[model samples]
Target: MSRKIAWIAAGGLAATLTACPARTPSLPNTPAPIHVPPGCEKNQTGEYHHAENPAFLYFGEDDGGTLTLGVARAREGLEGPGDAGTTVNIVLQRTPDGFVGETRSTTFTPSGTACPVRFPTEATACDDKGLTLRSVAATSIDENCRPAPTGPNPQWKEQRLVRGAPDAGASDAG
Candidate 1:
């Protein structure tokens, strides 16, 4: 009968629709691994020094400051179960002269493409008198230029402030 035919057609259409697989949304461009120059190695440590402001030194707790740099092992291509690569996060107070006070957190990734590690220079602070503080020197760790990871997690290695401005010299040497 017409009813039977209609039911059969509806069932066939429903079955066909269910048989098709769902499509997944395309993912955005993932960044490649950051490059690590010679002397820079995995788990290596260092400090982000202020050229002029000695108080604004980025080092570990043992270095007389609170801010400490941390790193984690990341799989190639930045794929991993936890924090990928060497992540560098800084926990310091923002000051008119530069980052002062306690260093809240910092991570450094020693591989892959360049990523922004932190706000190295500040116009108001470092650019004072037209002279930039400039990240004079850093320890021999792979400092990747990428955004720091977030969340209430723990797996980062604490970095100590080995040296700072007036002593730590100047250069982007991690």
Candidate 2:
């Protein structure tokens, strides 16, 4: 009887071990953050807001040798001829390095004027990740209904806009 009891107990232990599979390590609650390039910070990746201005910048996939970006502002309202909201399509051609490029801004005003803005000495940099873009209040109008950099360049000028949150994956505007 004792031997039979021992045998049954051993078999039950084996069965119990086999009945329950090994436990796996629990997964984390949130996914890991995205990756970013070195020396790069975040720019206008998604929705951006300051005190009085709201802006958006979208960087699309590279098409051939050109890069496309959608720049939009929805807060400023003009009286004569413009949408309360406006979007500027930006097309850029890269130089040798990935840092420098030529940008052409094309926008149609509310007055039905198609304007292309370019300068002889134009340079586009995503340097330091457009740290000052958030400071812009969108005071871009003078007496004339034109785009004006009324604020300081370093404080209000648009620069490299990224595609992720500033803390998570602040990457290049690819």
Name the best candidate (by TM-score): 2
lDDT of 2 by residue, 1-174 (tens): 999999999999999999999999998798444332333223323332222222443444444444455544432343542333444444444434432333345455566666655322112434333322212323333334466656444323444354433333332231
Error of 1 at 151 (Å): 38
In Å, residue 45's CA in model 1 sits off its true spot by: 3.5
* Model 2 accuracy (lDDT, Cα): 0.42
lDDT of 1 at 23: 89
Runs off by more than 4 Å, candidate 2: 1-54, 74-87, 97-100, 106-114, 119-160, 165-174
In the range 41-149, model 1's lDDT, one tens digit per residue, is: 2222244443333333443332322233432322234456334333544443333334433212244455645434343421112211121222313322234443335
Instruction: List the global CA lDDT of all models.
Output: 0.37, 0.42
